[model samples]
Target: MRFPFFSRPAPAAVQPPVADGGTLLETTGLTKSYAGADGELPVLSGIDLTVRAGEIVALLGRSGSGKSTLLRCLAGLLPPSSGTVRYRGTPLTGANPGTALVFQTFALLPWLTVRQNVELGLEARGVPPRERARAADQAIDLIGLAGFENAYPKELSGGMRQRVGFARALVVEPDVLMMDEPFSALDVLTAENLRGELMELWDSGQFPTRAVVLVTHNIEEAVLMADRIVVLGSRPYGTIRETVEVDLERPRDRDSADFDELVDRVYRIMTGRPKDGRPAARPDAERTDPDRPDQDRTERRTLATTPLPSASVDGLSGLAEMIAHRDGRCDLADLADELGLDIDDMLPQVDALDLLGFAEIHGDDLLLTGDGTAFAHADVQDSRALFAGAALDVPLVRLIANSLSGAPGAAVRAGFFRDLLAHHYTSEQIDRQLETATDWGRYAGLFGYDAGRREYRLEEPETGR
Candidate 1:
C-alpha cells in the first residue's frame, strides 16, 4: 500500500516542482567563536554548507557539535565571526528575510490566542490586519488546529501549542523554514505523529516553505526525514565531517534491511568510524605514522584537546559488562535498541570506554580490549585498581590527581581548575568536565571531592605502602 501522504493531492495554490530548485541559502568558510577568559573559544570552523529549494537537509551532531549554532547562522540570527552567510547569493546583513524559525520551546505568547500568535509574523511585515487574519486561519487549518484558533497557549495541549508554532512559521511563507529540535520536547508518540504529518504535508506540496533545514541530534530522525544528512564533528571545534545522501523512497521503514543498514552506517560515522570501516584520525592528533591505532594518539592529549566525556564510572562499567556478556563484541546500534535508548544517549559511555582504552569501535560494532575484558570479569578491588591506572592515563583526571597531591595540605579549590578550563570551554561545558572528573577520580580512589567546600583532596596512602 502507498503511504497516506503520498496518496494525497496538492492544494490548489501549491504544485509539486517539476525538478529540484536553485540554492536558497549558503555558507562559506563560516567560523564562529566567543571571547573567553584566556582567548577566543571556537565553536565552529571552516564550515561550508548549502540548502536548496527542493530538499530537506538535516544538520546532525552531538551536544557540543554546534548544530544549533549553524542553524542560527544560516537564519542570520547570529553573525559568523569570520566568512559569510548568504541568502539567494546575497551576503546577509541581518536576519534573513527568506527564512522563518520554529524553536524547540513553542515560544508562544501565553497571553495571545492561537490566531493572534500566528499573526505576529505577518503583523511585523506590515501585512494588513484583515490579510493577516486570513493567512493565519489558513495556516492554522492546514496544521490541524482549525477549531482552536481563539484559545490561548495555556488552554492548549503541548502538542497543540507546538502546532501553533508551526502555524506561525508557516503563515509567513518564507523561502526556507528553519527548525531547531522542534519535536524533541514532545513525547515519543507525539513526536512520531507530528513528524509523519509534516512529511506528508511536504510530500503533498501543501508545505508553505520552499525548503527546510533541521537541527537534530537524533540519528534515526535524520535518516527518516532528510534528503541529505550533514554530520557534524565536535572535538576542539565543530566541522562538517561527512554528508550522506538518503536515496531511499519516502515512508521509510525502520525494520527494512536497507533502512537498518543506513542507520548502522550513520551510527558508525558518529562514533569515529568512516564509511570504509577505518577509524578516522583524531582532531587533535599530530601523529606522523598513519598506521597507529587511535588509542596511541591519546598520548598527546591535554585537557583542552581531549576533554572528558560526561560519563560516570558506574555507567561506563555497566556498558563494558554488557559487551563482555555479548562475547566481547556487540553492534552498537543493536545494543542501543536493546537498551531502549537513542544511540546518541549511549555515546558518552561508549566514548568513555574508548577514551580509557577499555574498548574500541570497529565500524558498527563495539569490541572490548584486553583490559576491558579483564576489568569486566574482575572483582571489585581488582576492578578499582584497573580503573585507577586507566583514569590516571587520561589527561584531565591525571591533572586533578596530581594537582591535589602537590598542593599545600593536599587540597585545592575546584575554582582553580574551573579557571583553567574557562580558557577552552563555556561555563556549561566546564561544569560537565569537572563533574565527570569528580566521578572518575572518586571511583579510582585517586582523589576525594568535598562538595560543600568545593575542594579536591588527595587520597592518603595505605599503611603498608
Candidate 2:
C-alpha cells in the first residue's frame, strides 16, 4: 500500500540546521493554568519552542496534550498564565497582525461568499474594499479556488471549504500561519492532496507566510510536513517530551526506510517505549497474566492514570488482520496510511492489541502473536471464547467481576469501581477507563452493567469452564 506519487528522488540532504534561522516566534517558559475546584489545573508547564522564518513546525501530542492551547498562545489568541511569547524580540500581548489562524472546523462565515470570507481579514485591518478584493482574488487563485470565488461556504465541499480557509489566512498575508488540524476534517484522498499542495506552495516560495505552526495528533502528518516535530506529554501538565527533526526530502515515501524509522521513533517517544524494541509492560500483563505483579501493577496504575487510548474492537480486529495478512507483521506508518487513519486513530488500536498480548509493538511494526493469528482466523464462537478469556484475565476486569461475584446480591455498585479507578486515574481518565472496561466486559461476557442502576453483575462464563 505505497503510492509512487508520494515519492521523490532523495536529495543529498534535506535536514535543516539545529538553528535554522533567526527565531520568528519564541516562547520562554510558557505555562498555562486554569482555576479549578480541586486546585489549579495546569495545562502546559515550563515549555519553550521556537518557529523560525521559512520553517514549518508541528506540535504533536495526544488529545489532552495542550497542542491547540499552545497554538492559541503563540497566535496571541490566549493569554498565558505565565512566561513570555515574543515575535521578533517584541512581546506579543494580543493577536498579532502578522499571524493568521486556520481552524479544523473551517470557520468561514455562512453569509459570506468565498471571496468575501477571504476579504474579511483584510477588512478588519482597514484595507480598502478594492485592495481587499484584489488580495482575496489572488489568494483564491493561489489556493485553486479561482472559479468558486462567489460560492458560499455551505455550497463548498469539505476540502473546498478548507481551501477557502487557507485562502482567508493567506489573504491576510501573515508572516506566520497557525494551522490547527487543518486537514483532519477532510477525507483521506482530500487530505493527502491538500498536504501535497501545501508543500508545493511552500516550496515555490510564492506565499507570503514565512513560517508555519501546525497542531496535530497525526505523527505521519508531522513527519511529512514539519521541519521539526515537538512531542508534548500528557496533561494536566502537557510539557515537551522531545523534539525530532525530519530531514527527509519532500514527497517522502511513506514506505521508505528512513521515513519509517522516523515514524517509529516518534511512536516510541509517544508511548514511552524503548527504541530498542523491548516490549513495554502492558497494563494488564502483570495482574491478568500475573508475571510480575508488583512492578506490573505500579506500571499499570501509572499508565491508566493518563487518558485511556480510545480503541474500538473493530479497529483492533482490522489492524490484527492487516498484520496477519502481512505475515504477522506490518509497518506502523504504512499500515496507518493504507487504512486512511491518522497516527492518533491507529496507535490506540495497536495499544489495545499490545495490552491484550495479541500483538507486540516492536519499534514501528505490529507483530501478531500466535493467539492473534488464531483470533484473526477463528470462528465466531472461538473468537468470543478467546476474547472472554483474555478480558477476564485483565486485573481491572477481574477485580470488577470478583466484586460482583463475591457480593451478597451478586452485584456491586458502580461507584465502588469508579472510586477504585479514581485512586489511579484523574476524573476524566476514569470516565474513559470506565467506558473501556464496560465494553471489554460486555464482549467477554464476564459482566453485565446496568447503567440505570449503576451496578455490575457477574455473567455466565463463556469458556474454559
Candidate 3:
C-alpha cells in the first residue's frame, strides 16, 4: 500500500509545514480491505485518529487483529481503501522526513553496525554524511546503544537490536514515530526494561519525535504507557471495537488493586458483551480510570461516542451530470470552466475518482461512471469545506459524513470551512473566486458553512449580524 493515498486530493491551501504543533496527525474514514480467496477481507474500518505533539498513543489488540495494519496505514506504509491520512493538513506519503516506523521484526541490516543502520534512512534521503553520522550517534546514545555503535546486528542482543531499530527511525527527528509491536521479540524482562527506558527517554525529550504510537497486546503495558489505548476487533477485517483512555497518575503500580481493576475493565470491554451504539459500553471508573483507581464511581462517562457527521452526498456525478445531462456531452474543459478550475490542478482528482471506480477517465474527456453518476444524483450535506477542498467539481465528501447530523433529509452545507481558509488564502484570492485553490488552514473544521443557512460557520460566532 502507498502513502499519501487520499480518497480525494486535498486542497492545496491545506499544506502543513513542520512548525505546526497543536494537532499533529489525523486520519479520516480509514478502511483497509483486501481481496482474498474467499472474499473481501476487511482489516480495519472507519479508524479516525488524532495525535498531538508530545503525546504517546498506544495501539492494543490481540495478535492478527489489524492493530499493526492500522499502524502501517498511519505511517503511510499501507494505503486505506476509503479514507485520508493527514499529517498536519497535508496528505502523508511514504516515510516523510517527519515520520518513521519501527517494525515488529526490527528490520535491521546484518552487515551494518548499529551506527550505520541508524544512518541508512538519512543517507537514503540525501542528508550530508557528517550530519547523518552525528544524528545516528545521538540516537544510539539515547537508546542506550552507545557502546554498540560499531557492533554488527549479529553481536547485539535482541533488545539491543530493537534499540538499533528505534535509533534508525529516530535519527530523522520525525514529528510522528510509530512502532509496530516493536518489543514482542524480546523476553519479558528485557522488554520491560527497554519499555521503561524508552518511556524515560521520551519524557526527557531525548528523542525528537513530536508524538509516539506504540502497538502492543500486553494490556498492562498499554495501560501503563498510553494516554489512550485503541483495541481493534478481530478480523478477516473489522473496525475498532473500543478505545480506553488512561488518565491515571504516573508510576502506575501493576500490583495495586486499582491497576488490577483497570485491566479487568479493558478485558471485559474486549471479551465481554457488546454494549450500545458504536464506541460501546460506558465503563465505571473503578474499572478504567488509572488516576482515580480507588474511586469506584468517578465523574467521567466512559465510551462516549463522537457524533457522526451527516452523510454529505456531494455527488461528483451530481455535479458532472448537472453539467453533462443538462448541457449534454460534458468535456473536461467545459467542466473545468464551470467549476472554476484549471486542467492541471484538476488532473489528480480525476485520477483519484477513476482509481476509486467513481468516474472514467477517457482519453481527452472524462465521464462519470454509473456509480459516480448515482453519487452525483444524490444530495449531500458535508463540511462546507468540501467545496473549499475539492476541485470545483468533486466535493470534500468525508467532511459530509463527519459533520452533517443536524439537517433532516438532503442537508448540504457550503462554505463550512471558508473562514478557516482565510489564513491561507489571500484577501485577493478569497475574493479571487475560489476555483482550484482552497484555504487548508488549521482548525478549518470550524469554518464550514451550514448548507441550509448558506452562511459560513465560525468556531467563535462572528460578532456582526
Candidate 4:
C-alpha cells in the first residue's frame, strides 16, 4: 500500500509506528456546554472514549451531534464543563501538546509559503531554524508537496492547500493527529485521491502520528478509514450512542458485502434502530406510548425537549413519494444511494417524517405509515392537505399556530418564539429550529412569517384544523 511519493527517508523526529499499544487520548464523563442567552446549552454529555495507539478512530454523526465538539475536546481546543480529557493518561490543563489538528477549511496563512507554513509549529517549539527547515522539507516531500514548497497558499488548489495542512501537522510530529472533516471541503475525486494516499501512508507504517482521530458526517468515509467508529446521538444533547469496530482489511472494497453490511448497521444505529429488533431507546422523560393518539403524543412534546430537524416540507414529502414508489418501504442505505445522497444528508428528512408520523424506521428499513402512503399518492392540493395535518402534529408548528391564534390581529412577533427557544438552544441552533418550524408552519397553511416585520401571522381559514 506504500506509494512511491511517500517513500522518502523519515527525519529524526518522524518516529515509526510503535507496536506497544497505549492509550493516546482518553475522555471520561466529558461534558461540554455553552452559556446560551437564557441558560446553559449542553453539547456533549457523559462521553467516555479512548483512542489507542496504531488506530484511526472516526467520530461519526450528523451536524449538531457534537462530532466536532468531541474532536475539539480531544485536542484540548475547548475546555469541557465537567470531567477530564487526558493525553497519555495525563489530564490537560490547556492545549494538548501531544496532538495536532487539521481543519476542514485548510486553515493556512496566505502570506506564508508552503514550507514556512509547515515550519510554523517547529518555530513555535523553539526548534533551530536549520532543523525546522530540514523537518519541514521532509514532511513536504513525504506529503508530495516538495516542488510546491515555495508556493504560497493563494496559488494552490484546494487539494494542494490541504496537503500543505497535512504537512504542517506532520512536521510537528504530534503523538495524535486530529482531523475535523479535513477532506470534506475538497471535490469528491480529489478527496478520494488524498484519502487513499493518506491511508496508504498509514498502512505502510510511515504515518508520523501514533493515532488519528477524525470527525466526519460521511458514513462511508468513516467505514473506509476508521479502525473504530464512534457514533454520536443528537437528541437530548450529544452522547456516544454506539461504537462499532471495523473488522474488514485495509484498502477496503466499498462494493464488498461486508462493507455494505457494516454501513447498513451504522445507519440503523444512527437512525435509532436497535440491533435486537426492539424500539430504539429514548430519554426517559421524552418517551411516550406508541399507541398514543397523535395529539396526545404532540402534547407530550415541547420545543425545548423535541427540537425540530432542519427538514423542509418539500424535501420530506419527496422522500415519502420515493418510499411509496418502493411500495411503502425501502432500505435506508439503498435509498440514500439511489438518491445520490450521503446517509447524513437524508437523516433530517427521515427525522421529519418520523416526527410527523409519516414514517417509522424498522430495523434498517424506512416504512411509510398508512398516512404517508396516502400523502405520497395524493395530488398536489390533496398532498398539501395531508402534509398540513401531519405538520400540526409537531410541537413547534403546533405552538406557532396556537400562538398566532391567540395573538392580536392573529399575528405574533417571531422574536417571541426565538426568545423562548433561547433558553434551550444556542443562537445558531435557535435559528435552525425556528427555520424548520417556519417551513413546516407555512406549508401547513397554519402560519406565515413576514421577514420584514419578523412576525408570524395566522393563515386565513386554516385548513388543517
Compare the candidates by lDDT and give the number of the best one: 1
Candidate 4's TM-score reads 0.91
Among residues 3 or more apart in sequence or in different chains, the pairs in candidate 4 whose N, CA or C atoms overlap within 3 Å are none
User: What global local distance difference test value does model 1 have?
Assistant: 0.85
- The candidate, 1 or 3, that scores higher on lDDT is 1
Task: Estimate, for each residue in 378-443, the C-alpha lDDT of model 1 and write its tens digit.
Answer: 998899899988888888889898887554348889999999999899888999999999999888
Worst 10 residues of 2 by lDDT: 1-10
* Model 1 TM-score, all chains together: 0.90
What lDDT does each candidate get? Answer: 0.85, 0.76, 0.58, 0.84
lDDT by residue (352-426, candidate 3, tens digit) is 444333454333345555445544554443333332333222233234323444342333444543443343332
Give the clash count for model 4: 0
Q: Rank the candidates by lDDT, best first.
A: 1, 4, 2, 3
By TM-score, rank the candidates, best first: 4, 1, 2, 3
As a whole number from 0 to 100, the lDDT of residue 460 in candidate 3 is 37
Q: Find the number of clashing residue pairs for candidate 2.
A: 0
- Compared with the true structure, the alpha-carbon lDDT of candidate 2 equals 0.76
Which portions of model 3 show Cα errors greater than 4 Å? 1-21, 37-39, 274-465
The parts of candidate 1 lying over 4 Å away from their true place are: 1-19, 281-298, 406-409, 461-465
